[model samples]
Target: MASENDYINYEMQKRTEPLLGVVIHNDASELNANEWREVLINAPEERYVQGIAHYYIDRNGQWQAIDTENIAWHTANQIGNEQYLGYEVLESLSSTDEEFLLNEQETFRVIASDMIDYNLEPNRDTVKLHLEFSETECPHRSFEIHTNWKTTVDGIPDEWVINDLKDYFISQIKQYMLN
Candidate 1:
């Protein structure tokens, strides 16, 4: 029988790779239910084929977030890009509003629930935090953030790829580097 870690690692790898694009949101706590829903409804339609979302919470409180596989809206007009992942954190760096701590757990639960139906397992490698790929102080600085996000550093392993797959990724990397 496969160990729990092995199963988790396999599931994580499956969720992490084969994605077209990834979308990172700044923060989810500032938006209300309607606003948040609208954002989900008006997501981008460019290269966002598949994506995941992340959120931060202050001390792990209860929170509720929405999940929309198709519909989308933009908070700052950044959701137009298609084929990506999304995340919403429930914490604030500059502001100390207790409301920010509210519904965070629920948001995480809902996000996780959506992942189950997302046809992909929940894995840190596949899902990225806002801070991981961006230079902004987004997702908050005080909030304890999760870091398994696949930034440029945590790239896919060569051993994980077959000969053909390895060659394809290598070529792609070379092309990316050249460009």
Candidate 2:
């Protein structure tokens, strides 16, 4: 019989390399962080293709479902599964709420801290959105709300990239470290 810890041990063994960056995703179900955790924990593990995300962020704040060293099942097409750490931001059922917004900002700060720890750049090289690999419009509201914060690339507006978002987080991290 497979031991209870077998899966965890297998996941750890499979992660032989360091993560390359971070991938941001949205949990479209409109559940808060804690509720989402309950759903994931209760659901069958095999339902996830890449495995569950390493972290989740919502009105209740950030929660780690899996260790960063383990590969998360957040990306589609198997893209960046082994190369990146993944985070899922909880989506509200209706209009976006202030609590969710605050949690989102906190999520960014966490990502920025991770970037500093991993020595990754605050740009496309280290930060990415789920849309970059899949056709679905995941993290939909997040993109919509942050459209004005986009950066220009090759003289064209690139609204979907996470560079500007990362930049903001990086600034926050700098300010935090200075204090």
Tally clashing residue pairs in candidate 2: 2
At residue 46, candidate 2 shows an lDDT of 65
Q: How many backbone clashes does candidate 1 have?
A: 38
In angstroms, give how far residue 30 of model 1 lies from its true place: 4.2
Best by TM-score: 2
TM-score of each: 0.39, 0.73
Q: lDDT tens digits, residues 42-75, model 2?
A: 5664655445677777655666766766777677
Model 2: worst 10 consecutive residues (lDDT sum)? 1-10
In angstroms, the error of model 1 at 5 is: 36
Estimate, for each residue in 1-179, the C-alpha lDDT of model 1 and write its tens digit. Answer: 11011110011111322333333344534554334334443455331223323222233332222223332222222332223344454344333545443433334444444444455443434344344443434443223223322323444323232233223323332343333
Model 1 alpha-carbon drift over 4 Å, by segment: 1-30, 35-67, 71-81, 90-98, 141-179
The alpha-carbon deviation from the true structure for residue 32 of candidate 1, after best TM-score superposition, in angstroms, is 2.1
| TM accuracy, model 1 | 0.39
lDDT of 2 at 137: 64
